[model samples]
Target: MVDATIGQGGHSYLFGRALGPQGVVIGFDVDEKAMEKAEERLKTLKCRVILVHSNFSQIADELNNQGIKGADFILADLGVSSPQLGASEFGLSFLEDMPLDMRIDKRIQRSAADIIKYLDEKSLADLIYQYGEDRASRRIARFIVQSRKDFPITTTGRLANVVCRALGNRGKGRSRIHPATRTFQALRIAVNDELENLKALLDSAPEVLKRGGRIAVISFHSLEDRLVKYNFRKNKEENVYEIITKKPLIPTRQEISENRRCRSAKLRIARKISEGD
Candidate 1:
């Protein structure tokens, strides 16, 4: 079993408990703190737990180095974890005032602050449009570029304020989502190189899983859901794997009410259909 992006080990703990003593579970996370938390939680589990501080895109090579050719089951829950959003260091949420650093992996040199300060207006606008899918990307980029001229926009609060100012305050009982939500999400995704990492994972998963092995991915946004959908369809057409979920599965209304973040999540499953050379 493999748990990619094993955030707080919530999913892996359950996977480990079911695996028993004979089963081995390999987990990956970019955040050292998250790995530490996961270790503490999974310490007493019956299965052998191996945790690595790395991105899931490296899963194929990592497994091969450990003398494991293929896994029977693999799972990836993509997106920012709850703790990350609440943590000040990550700067993932605008709900709290924090440094504009969204690098989950501290090793990453370029941060959200760097992007805000360095990126040209057109490039920034393009990034916002492509990643955030926001129609007012140009206006937001203009606001950011103009705001940073007076002083470096180095805090989440300032960035959020700029976005809200550029887009205008529609949050006054008009919309549940904040005006800065999409822009913040775009910055987070860019800082982490999320989409490319996800693509790499998708490209490598089939080869890493054994024939009949199952792979499950839980994505939190439309961009991710679309990528999973099309990739699964392409793989199915090529006879590499069979899609287990015809349509992506979403959280129930009850689940959404209990956990508002789960409202956007979609789960897609697929199984390897052929053996590798």
Candidate 2:
């Protein structure tokens, strides 16, 4: 079994326990902190746990390096972890005045700050529109460009402020979500190249799985969900996959009431279908 994006080993823990003493679990995570935390949690498990401090996009090569041909099960959770969002080091939350880093993988050269500082207004606007699905991307981009001229938008707070001002904040009680939410999401995705990595993972998953192996993906936003949805559908047509969840499975109401963040999550599962099938 392979747990891709094993943030804090939450999913891996259940998988490890289920596999018991006979299974081998390989987990991949780009964040060093998450890897360490998962390692500590998985230490007592009976299965052979191999944690890789790398992106799941490199799953095929990593498995090959371990003398593993294919996995029986693979799972990937595409949502940013709570720790990553809450920690100042990750720079994901606009609620705090943290430095605009937002690189889950420290090895990545460009940070959110670098992206904001370097990209031209048009490119930045396109990124916001494409990644964030924000309609006011042009206005936000113009505001950011203008704001940078004054003192450089260096912190999450400053960027958030700029976005709010650009969008004209709806006072305190009127708005449900932050005005800067979409822009911040756009920056984080751009900084991490998340969609591209997801694409790589989707492409590699089938090749790295044994015939009839199961694969599951949990995506938070429409962008990620749509990608996974269409990819699995296409693979099914090609006889490369058998879609298990014809429609995505979402969190139950009780689950969402307990954890509001899980409200947007959508789970899709598929099984590998060899040519014989």
Tell me the TM-score of each prediction against the true structure.
Answer: 0.97, 0.96
* Inter-residue clash pairs, candidate 1: none
lDDT of 2 by residue, 1-277 (tens): 9999898999999999999999999999999988899999999999999999888889999999999887999999996999899999888888889988899999999999998898999999999999888888999899999989888888999999998888885523345778887788888888888888999999998889999899999999998999999999999999899999989999999999999889889999999988432
lDDT of 1 by residue, 116-165 (tens): 99999999999999999888899999999999999889999999999998
- Per-residue lDDT of 46 in model 2: 100
Q: What overall lDDT goes with each candidate model?
A: 0.91, 0.90
Q: Please estimate how well model 1 matches the true structure, expressed as its whole-model Cα lDDT.
A: 0.91
User: What lDDT score goes with residue 192 in model 2?
Assistant: 86
Task: Give residue 195's error in model 2 in angstroms.
Answer: 0.7
Q: How many backbone clashes does candidate 1 have?
A: 0
